[model samples]
Target: MKLLASGVFALATLMASSALAQAQAPANYGPAIPGVCVYYGAQTLAQSTVGQSVSTRMNALSQEVAGELAPYAQSIETEITALQQGRASIPPAELQSRSQAVEQRIREAQQLEQTRQNELRYTLDVQRRAIATAVDPIIVAVYQERGCGLLLDRESVYLMNPAMDITPTVIERLNVALPSLSFNRLQVPVDQQQAQ
Candidate 1:
């Protein structure tokens, strides 16, 4: 019985020691290290000179499309007016033919407008992506220059040291590296289309 009691006490002591060791061991929290810089991409883009240039170019393109569509708008209105006034005087067959022609023209104009809008949207997206890509090497250069081991997006962090914020520095670097991107429409590579 004494031996049994001694054995139980020894087992309890070993269990306690194991628990204490585990409590002292450092937790495996993730790959994040101390003193890494974080940047807000949206803020950086908005403040960058290239971003403003892109916005201005997009606005100009929109205005140009609107001006180009103005004549079609007037023609469509005139066609509608003519159809309404000639409904009684025009023979049934002639009226039907005119109606179909007017509908086809209107559809064509709408399709043309839609195509223009899509092209503009695609061009703007491509430009924005190009700007982001151009800024990537700059981001790496800045991160290395600042001696930060890690660079992360500001959105993921809830709180951080103000000194660890690198957005302003990144924006400055981007301004020097790339002042503006091409605002013109991007052409899809013909080789890529053929491959598809």
Candidate 2:
């Protein structure tokens, strides 16, 4: 659960840094013109209604996974506490076996935690791709509508007129095109899970 929280924070931090970079762009790039435009893909995705829905859904899923694993965690903690309290009275051989069992349980819990994290990550990636898919044509349409010949990622630009940013237009069209997305946790295949 701590790992999941940290992962979410890391994602937020990355998005914030991206936005800051765009904000710090030099402001003297002359007046806006046709045939050239910038799009802040990260910011657009983060700010859009559908994107917020995805984020809310992901947090719910993370909480669900934590709840599902709570018993394993509790059981492990109980066993460890019992072992420590009775250590003086336990025979050496029995103590070794019990300790090994506890270790095995810990390892199993760790593996489960890792699997859950991987599933969450995979689910997020898939959803982000879906959102991107929905946003692509909208962006293209906006580009053509705005008569843009060069479409640059905001991340790649160090200077641009604020008016030249088509991100809001793209996001608006995306909200109309895809107001929300419904998805479930992606159950990664065994082979892929092991690879991760």
Q: Candidate 1 at residue 8, lDDT?
A: 43
Tens-place lDDT digits, model 1, residues 117-171: 6666667678878888988888888788878887888768755555677888889
How many pairs of residues collide in model 1? 0
Candidate 2 local lDDT, 7-37, one digit each (tens): 6786699688867866786757688987899
After aligning candidate 2 to the native by TM-score, how far in Å is the CA of 149 from where it should be?
A: 1.5
Give the RMSD in angstroms, all C-alphas superposed, for model 1. Answer: 20.9
What lDDT would candidate 1 get against the real structure?
0.73
* Among all candidates shown, the one with the greatest TM-score: 2
| lDDT scores of the candidates, listed in order | 0.73, 0.86
C-alpha TM-score for every candidate: 0.70, 0.87
lDDT for 50 in candidate 1 is 88
